[model samples]
Target: MRADRLISILMMLQMEGRMTAAELARRLEVSERTIYRDMDALSISGVPVYADPGVGGGFVLPANYKMTIGGLTTAEIQAVFMHLAGGSFEQLGIGPPLRSALLKLLHALPDQSRRDAEWIQQRIYLDPESWSQDEKTAPYLQAAQQAIWEQHAVTMTYTSREGHELCLKLKPYGLVAKAGVWFLVGETEGNVRAFRLLRIDSLEGKQEERFVRPEDFDLQVFWQEWLEKYESR
Candidate 1:
């Protein structure tokens, strides 16, 4: 969390041009003293950040200074890719930046690291069926996650257990894949619904408009409730 906080601070400074230590602490939910310490750490480590105590001064980095993760070890690089693989690369907004970052990481490695990375990929295989209703749906799981995270609506045709079929436009809230099936939880108009990905005929989404996900919502709680309801049926 500390590392993530530091990265966020740096990025905030980069985006906002300048930010006071108090403001940084408030944003990161840390003490002003901690922000000072983090700033010191960044500056000493060649970050080229500067902070001033005057009324109109705060941390600032040079306009063209770019940070690169081009020195990670093979294991570190592989970890990055493995994390990215957890969701649909096509739909997650982080995918493009991750791909670019991955390329830099791979290019920075030595020849041995590159070979080891390939070996790691070959050996590290996931059994998607155990995680989903069917492994065939794994690729589209990311699509559901993306819609949820972006608050975009999704349109999919799903089949029911009783052999019924329906096409729906859902406000995708979250995705859960377990026991070899994936489910999308969201509301259609004002009704909550869950659809098994394996039964979905086609999936589509657009970001033309978005909605705010509820603040008091928890995916796990919703899931448990759904399970209880299912068992009672």
Candidate 2:
């Protein structure tokens, strides 16, 4: 548990740049003394974590310093690959990278950890498709994903449920995969709408400065509410 706690502190300082001991202790639910001790442990372990002094001072990692994930236990190694093997990575375009990463980790892991991982791999499997339905194809799904990552708008051509060809410029927010279908959630004409990715005939990302995402938008909350209204109809 202390290993996980120390890693958490390391990650927090790495991402947040500077955090007061009080803040770290509060978030980590430990005492300030414990946070300081953990900081020392991290420093001794060769993690470049250091503390600032006086007003607005805390702990920070160097801006350019980063460490790759290593020292994985059997359970950790298993957990990392379970979801990648569960059948969505290909459509999301991350399958190859995940496979390469798994191979790298497997090659470096202890023999027992590798054996445990291989045993689980041979035993447990996952497929997300439904037996009764055909898998839907979304040729533009990757482009939509790109637009979301780029924080840009896209001009998209799609057929509506009523079967009309229409075009709209959408501020792409996120993509959701349900069963075997993908949905593009975006803001268009001052309203957020979910467009079935299969129906989108084309998508062209805007080549402009990054669009500002709304401050209050929460994708998880929005998706859950969307599902409620969608399934009710």
| 119-158: candidate 2 lDDT, tens digit per residue | 8899888777657544545789899899898898899899
TM-score of each: 0.51, 0.71
List lDDT for all candidates, in order.
0.75, 0.84
Candidate 2 error regions (>4 Å) = 1-3, 12-48, 51-58, 62-71, 132-134, 159-166, 214-217
Model 1 scores a TM of 0.51
Error of 1 at 179 (Å): 7.8
lDDT of 2: 0.84
- In model 1, the worst 10-residue window by lDDT is 125-134
Candidate 1 clashing pairs, residues 3+ apart or interchain: 88-142, 132-180, 132-181, 133-180, 133-181
lDDT score for residue 171 of model 1: 86
| Cα lDDT of model 1 by residue, 71-181, tens digit | 446767678667655434333346588778767766766778777766777778544334433454444577788888789988888879988888888888887765446
Q: Which ten-residue region of model 2 has the weakest summed lDDT?
A: 128-137
Q: List the residue pairs that clash in candidate 2.
A: none
**In candidate 2, how many Å is residue 143 off?**
1.5
Best by TM-score: 2
